[model samples]
Target: MKSSIRRRVLLLALLPATLLALSLGYFFTLSRITDLDQALRARGLAIARHLAPACEYGVISGNNQILQRLADSALAEPDVVSVYIMDRGGNVLASNSLKQSKLAGIQPGDIPVSSQNDTVTVATRSNVLFFRMPIRQTEVQVDDFALTSTPAPAIQPVNAAPLGYVAIELSRKATMERQNEVLRSAALLTIAALIATALLALRLGREITVPIMKLASAVDKIGRGYLDVRVKLGGNDDEFRILEDGINGMVSKLHRAHDNLQEQILQATAKLSYQASHDMLTGLINRREFEVRLERALFSAQHQDREHALCYMDLDQFKIVNDSCGHVAGDELLRQLTLHLQQEVRERDTLARLGGDEFGLLLENCPQDKALELAEIMRKTVEDFRFSMGEKNFMVGVSIGIVMINHESDNVVSLLTSADAACYAAKDHGRNRVHLYQMQDSELAKRRGEMQWVNRIQLAIAENRLQLYFQQIQPLQKQEQGLHVELLLRMIDESGQCILPMAFIPAAERYHLMPMLDRWVMENSFKLCDAYIAPDSCELQTWAVNVSGASLCDAGFVQYLKSHLVDNPALARTLCIEITETAAITNLGAANTFIKELKSLGCRFALDDFGSGLSSLNYLKNLNVDYLKIDGAFIKDMADDAIDLAMVEAINKIGHQMGLLTIAEFVDSERVLLKLKEIGVDFVQGNWIHKPENAEALCKT
Candidate 1:
């Protein structure tokens, strides 16, 4: 503020004063030059008038010497550069000039000119004035300075005619020198005055900027979190006083806010730390922190031969409690049950809430018997506990699985795998019981492992954690065109591995999870291929998503699809639900209805894994599937086996007769693709054709 004010004030004071001084000096100098020029022109004219009449007689008689002498007399003046005498024909009769050397920087060929008349003058190339006057053949006036003729020179009559012209070149060097001198003096005075004004402005600027600089420094400190910083300014200006007071008040308020902010930060950090490790309601360690401890237990078992026992416990009737009462009641029941469960275990035992109704325990140096005993105790405690919400009371139970952790339990997967399996087996047999894992029994272990996947697949679909894998179905023959990719569902384990559908599909099918999973795939596949769905789709692209048999038999499932797909007619046209050969065979009646309803709605269907079953060909006639994906088992060996090749050829012929496109799976070589093409298969898909890639990579919205 202070610097700007000083600069502006000084400029306002000095700019016009400087310009006025220079302007007055310029015009005064110009007026002086003009007056001097008029005087010089008059004097030159008088001289020319005197010389013109004297030359009239010379012009009349054409006496060259007389005219030349008269011109020479005129040039005797120091400033007179050149004088010319010309007759009326505009030819110079005689002319004289000062020595070329005396007229510094001027060329010898320079001549005076009169563009108008005697009054007209022009500047030469150099700084010399050029002028001309007419030489009149008239009676001469007897002046005091003129040569008085007795009867006045009657060589020509007065105002009779202009015999010739007289021209003169005058030097203006002295006039220019005077103008330069005045300009130099004026410039020196302006510079001196501006220098004084600048010094005065700077002195004033410092007085005002001192307080403002101090305030800016305070503001900078406050911006850097120094809330206590204040500006100190001493000035007679009322504005400075008000500014100082405002700054001090602001700093005071910020100092208070800083204290409150630090308290908030401390509280927030503590809350975040608690939430990171412990469950909010039960106050037990969460899954992440519990797993971290489980990892340490695994390391101890592997390296130190330390034996431990881990129990995976799940509340069996907790869902019933949540359904009967509200979630708040369920939370209260879980909180109270946490206390009873904690009382059943020793202080050294680590317990954690895995997720939802599941909990885990790590027992150090415990044998299988002790683990079973503890697990039973926990199960019995949960069975005996009765939870109450308002006037209603309910009983709950827990299923516990006890697994022995020893040197063999070297990894988190093995320990968790056994404990989770045992717990699920307990639930499978009956709730409110404990089961000990039998490690040496492969059948029990396999069943336990697979049954556990039922819950995992259910959770994956519910959580939308399943991803899609895509394999391009390329045209084997020239009949098929446009993009056609088959959708394959994939699951990710907690360890972040892609678990193949073969690993968990049996569990999903047994537990009736595939209907939910099939719908999940159907919806997400359309969503992923959203870019390809358009009313004006020029290319025929197909996305074949696999469907489960249970979904095929569900009567309401077709309507469920209709509800979602009706809003997206373009997407419906591109969808192809692939039903396995076995599924379609078993549910042929329902499958036919489902296929017909969907086909009418512009959605297509495919008989997936076509030749895996011997009766697949018989069932094909009962269903109206649009495409037949010949099972890979037969196609993979068709190149070497004659029966397999015959089967492939027969399927292609049958499918073509049915007006259905035939796609051969597991085409792992160019030879296989050629054989499939020779068999007249419409499409072939395998690693050799196109590797199964992330579906999002090939189809993204």
Candidate 2:
């Protein structure tokens, strides 16, 4: 767990000492180079001091040849490349060089003169060194040169006069070469020591990383579910050894957990799936699962030319027993009937409870007549059987409708609708019998009417024949402003008159066309909102547009809504999205995600038709909604009914507890509004509050 194999610990261990040694040697070599520079300057000064006195005799005599001969002698010294004699006026008198060096003109002010020691000037160019010194005639110079064969004590002057100057140029190649040699030796020694250190470091790295490598390998194994992996390390009492002990202990615990986990995970995963797709009270698949399988069967029939039959079964008198003997007896009757019905079908066939007293049967590879015969048998069996609950006997019958599945069965809805109509038709004629669905039948003609509405709805959406109307959601408290509005969609009928959703919404929803209609209402409502409203201190305006559950099921619909929201900030800020409690409950996870994504853009969500589902209260906690629109059925009669009033009060209290605003729908009278206000309901919607008006009317305001 500490780290992977970078060997940084080993490298860091030796790094400081290596750097100290390198830095010490580097700085020492630099100091030696500086000392050599000073020594070269001293050597040049000595050479110039020696040559100046010799040139003094020549300068005083005004003889160029004598000066040249003296310069030539100076050039013969070690490292001397050029020699020059200049008068006190700073004019070059004589010069000698092995490589023909040119010296720049010197003037009187350029050469600074001094008395006791000849001032030395040093200049270097192109690796050649120049040293200039003033030539002073002191103690008579070389006039006594021939007279004093007795050495002359290196030209000590008693009184010196400025005669001329002498300059010498020397190369520093030899000194530089010596410095390079020393540096090379030091580098060689350092390299040898570093090699020894690096070898020691590598060996130490191997010793340090060996146990870590084992731990890493064990971690890899554990990541792949091999929890039995453990570190086989010794008891050294070191940190790595302690880590090994900890890892081994963790592995032992995980191994026990993994064994139990392996046994339970599969069952837990199955339970989750079953809860999502099946009714808990019955062992049969729910509507969503049944539709999913039906869609699959239709695809099979279309592609592979397979034959199947769908039987729609509705219990004739199950509600009678449920009302007389209570829900427990009704549940017992359904469970007992499910067992008998399940036994009547083959192992390959699927028997599903489609809610309430209704069930669905899918018979694969069965002929039309055979499916009908099987349906009759189920009907007769249900008619003959009597359910017993603690000495109370109950009888129930089932109406069976069988429809053949073929390539012509295009979708699950069409097949289910046709089968359902046939079952209802059977019940209309008689209580307990099997009926077959026919295309030319009156039941099928009614389905045709719904299908015709599908085309008209599509036309209405595309042609903008759809109109938006806003019904005000008023705060029951007079102090509170009712700035919020819910958008209602209206379609132009064949007679060119405005028609309510009741005329076309059922067909639209039944045929999966609500998504399109919902989109139309939302788009136009936002357009109207952008045109009409501006957010200000006086109001925080919001227009609520209903989002269909079908739209949430579409993975692309959220993105589609987001595309519009991204382009229109005003609409995103002022619009509120409303979804039915049933729709939100049906797609709970997706609804939560949808609300969150849009809410982040400054949009709000209202749970409309609230308290409609059996599990409505359970969903409200997880929905993260802004408004709870109480179901109209409870609110419409709340003023007359005590139970309805109590229910409204309870919902209002719960909504407030969850930080939600409660809106009561269908509050068409002042009496209902008074009751709602007493119950602390936040908002109300009804014709009495504000009649639905065209969304375009907002633009006029």
Candidate 3:
């Protein structure tokens, strides 16, 4: 709108100025021509008056010498083309030149005589004006008689009334041509002036618009999110000066606003993130966030083949602190204890709250002994740290459980559970003490084997040492129900031993190798389904590979799985991914998104170890899994333990209600199988049916 106004103003200003200049030039030229014509007429009339007396007197006496002299003098005028004299009889008497013969048909009466007293008769021919004047008796005194009359008695000149007229032919063509030459020069001057004015206007407009355009562009860039843009002020002192000042002001304000907005966004995001991940009371990472960080750290450690340790801490007699000092004081004491722990720990370690009064620390790139030393430092720090609540001081101490991670840990969960178990062991031995995980213990050894198996699984993936081992999940109801094989991952180690996941899964998880291991299993299982499985036999039952918490949380791992399927498109529909309820609940956001993404690609998900976690119902609704694996603990004791039987029955009932297939693990006895069948489990797996074996062995079945 403003630009339109400027354009309108410019047109208004330039148009009238141009037209007025041209009109003034035309009028000025016309006025000068009129004045020049009047001046030429005045001069022509004066010359004709002066020459008329000479013609009348000189010609009446028949004095050719005098007439010629008079004509010569009259022709001396600049505008006079010619002068001539003639007798009353219309005979030429005298002339300025011999060209009078060209006027043979012209007589003295041909020129009109002036009616006014002193005026000349002006006649025009072609572009020339003839000024003819009659010499009166007053202007010309002639002798009364000719020389032959002798008496000269007041004799009127014979054969001469006015003698002859004096005629001066002035060329109007020269006067008009001179006027045109002046007009042409004026027109050229006006054109040059207009061109110069236009150039000046253009230069001025550029000086104004160029800097303004630069400032406008800068403002646009800043609006688009570039806060660093600044304009260079050009050299101008008019409105450009004002514009520079205004733009500088706006830029300063924008910079401030940008900084303030950036700070506000950062603060808000940090606050929300902290609220989501940290314990409100202790200001430590919550269980969910801790697990995520631990998983990431473990994965990094495992991938680099580096050793790290996890320490789980629980405050001893924390209930006593709450009981004695009230919960408020207890909370303050926890805060104080956390501060002390942070002070004592190294910057590289992560200290997190695992719920209640429990805390966990991740010691990255640390060996067992070093982890122990750090744990001792933390223990002593808690024991010695003084807590105060409104002038009342108290003391609190924590028990520590340390688990050193190697290549053999199954997953992060196993490490956490192992460390938790070790923490319980510390509590059993005595409060305010530390305990390290020893592989010699049967449970710890099993966990260690699981961790080692995860490494072997990862190695198998990189070296192509992972082979698919399928086991028949036979139906107890009907023998001819056809074979449904549960796909298992077996890693061929350096020693050529086919290592089972049970031997290394817990370790893989403990050391954060699960996602890599799960990916390997998925790739190899799908590859085998494409290569070996016969489509006609048993419909080549879909194969399920277990996915760990880390794998479920991994956003990129889903893409990896998709890429594998793209490489083997035929196996994509036949493959299934198995995840535990605990894994799904640990990072619900990531897990749910990953599951949905894979599901879109024709891959399926099952909730393995369904009833083991706290949020089973929540995951079941959120994850939309196709199958639920009844935890082995409940299935192993289903025949003997009524609680186990009831739990299994409840899971099966819920699974069916949710339209999910139920698979029971660790169905080690016929009685267990019979019970699972009665409980309506959709699938069964255990030593009683058939242990996990090589694919070749399962194919023979």
Candidate 4:
């Protein structure tokens, strides 16, 4: 049978108490009984010893009356059952009881007779105790008159002869009664103790079982999906209280999770029909649905008199908000602006989020003039809307392009391109304006050129034509710092011509592709160092790689770098990551955190294009960097321009004051180099010092 906690507790608590009480009672009772028996035997032995000496004269004189008197006196004492005096022949001479007692059968020889010392012996018969002793006779002296003048004859004592024996019997009735009384009292006390123990055990069992039962019931309810159920146990702050708190906390989490689940379910239900067609972030129709609707509108315009307008709206300050405050604020800004934009458009108009800070609005049966007015309203709505994130607030503006869908419309792709080109024209003319598409828009040509560059960049990355190069940074102090170089990225065109970052970096940054470029640079830089530098030579070589502002603000870039470092941990010490001063100053907290994490793994950091930011010196103290690369603009003309020379001198002094190595770029002449060396610049790098070398071939060699 399964036992309840209460029952088990009761048994565990009561069993030992019962046994202890019983054991103590049994031992106490037995001790009392034994004491009574011993006391009775002591009284019997004392009576026998006294009666033997008292009957000594009587036994030698043959006087029964004297012996009778002595026997009577012994019998007069308490618990003395019988007393008898006997001769040496074993004949009873005197008795205190008419009935023959067991002591009368006791022989004189039964007790060892000692003339010099009294002898007493003891025995037990049924409920009586017997004490026997021997009586002895003293010798009479005959020589009494001796001459004083002569030497007195000494009289010597002799051992006396046995005259008779005396025995005493004691009844055990009173002692047995006392033992029975003690047993009764002890048994009563044991029973009372057992009852008290049982009561206490029952109370303790309840105290334990009540909390357990409450917990069990609460768990059952929770298992049945009643998240609100809580186990509220009342007690002092003990283990049970801790258990109660834990259970309640668990239930609270479950309740919160249940509520969140219900909310998600409701959101999922509402999104079921439109999820395929809408943007999950902004709740607007997605790009695919917008394209589909635009295609249908184009077919209608080609066949019938129905006209439509497509407006491409792009936010001007969205990137600033995104890169500065991160993507969370960017997403919220998009959602809020979507709602405001919806209010500006007609109910029949289709609004969709194209991608990243861009929105598309489709107006059916609307003329160019009405479409222009509607686009203007949306532009003003966005321009007036302020987005808030933490303590920072941002004002955003939209540059919109509106194109009328008519019989002249060719296809969806051409229409979207024309609209996009017009949008670019609006952004160029200054944002927060509306522009209509024209065939000869000059900005459209530039936009197309940049788009081509974007394609070329993508193609270069795919074809593995992106090249890694290094520019040597020479130490003017002649320190044995061993090969120190800054790694640079380049791309090759399909025509086998090399393209500098200046040709394609702006397009890549605008399209949010810098993270890809950064990953490639970091991965290949590590490979070059791992192959070129021996494991023991990592400390002798220092290689620097530039990380763009876009990659620094990217959320996953840090994790990607960490994973790569985990793979080639030895390469971390040899690599130095360089970030522009403007990028670090703009994102100080993230930059500091990034620096600390990598530096913990033995990687070093340097601030590139230093002295370029307005708050360069103020923010430099906050950034943890090992080296400072003076801005090339200041270094380029420092040899001739006194103001530029002073700037270079001041930046170098500050960099050294803060315990950092200073590197001057664009050191194209010995005059510039001598000036920097005089200013205590630690390193100089330019065409004059060393031209760019192919890093891959250099590492292989």
Please state every model's RMSD to the true fold in angstroms.
15.8, 18.5, 14.0, 15.2
1-701: candidate 2 lDDT, tens digit per residue: 44547457676757975897798778878888888877876788888887887777788889999998888888788788778788877788988877866565756455333433437766666676677787776763455456545655455654555787787778888778878987897788778877887888777776777777787889899889888677875536589878998999999999988888977998899899998898887788888898898888889999999999999999998888888889988888888888888778888888899989999999988889788778888888898888888888888888888889998887888799888878877887786888799888886676667778888988887776888887777766756543777778888876799988887887888878887777676666656666665545326477788888988777677888888888878678877888998888888888988988888888888898887789888768888888888899999899999998888898889999999988998988889989998888988889999999886665544
Off by over 4 Å in 2: 1-434, 437-448, 478-482, 534-540
lDDT of 3 at 248: 72
Best by lDDT: 4
What's the lDDT for all of these models?
0.79, 0.81, 0.75, 0.85
Task: Give the TM-scores of the predictions, in the order they appear.
Answer: 0.52, 0.42, 0.42, 0.53
* lDDT digits (tens) for residues 1-701 of candidate 4: 12477778889999999999989988988888889888887777777777787797799789999999998888889988688888877889998863567665667666433342446766666887777787876544555675667664554323655676787778888989998899889989999999999999889888888888889889989999998887888988599989999999999999999999999998998778588888999988899999999999999999997899999988897899989899998999989888888888898889999998899999999998899888888888998999889999999999998888999988999889888988988988988899998666677766766777888888899999999998888899777646778889989888998889988888887777888899898878777776776556444477789998877776688888888787777778777999999888888888888898788888999899998888898889999999999999999898899999999989989998999999999899999989988889988999999989798655542
Q: Candidate 1 — what's its lDDT?
A: 0.79
> Weakest 10 consecutive residues, lDDT, candidate 3?
152-161
Q: Candidate 2 overall Cα lDDT vs. reference?
A: 0.81
What would the C-alpha RMSD of candidate 2 be, to one decimal place?
A: 18.5
Cα displacement (angstroms), candidate 3, residue 495, comes to 7.2
Question: Roughly what TM-score does model 3 have, to 2 decimal places?
Answer: 0.42
Q: For residue 231, what is the lDDT in candidate 4?
A: 86
What range of 10 consecutive residues in model 2 has the weakest lDDT sum? 109-118
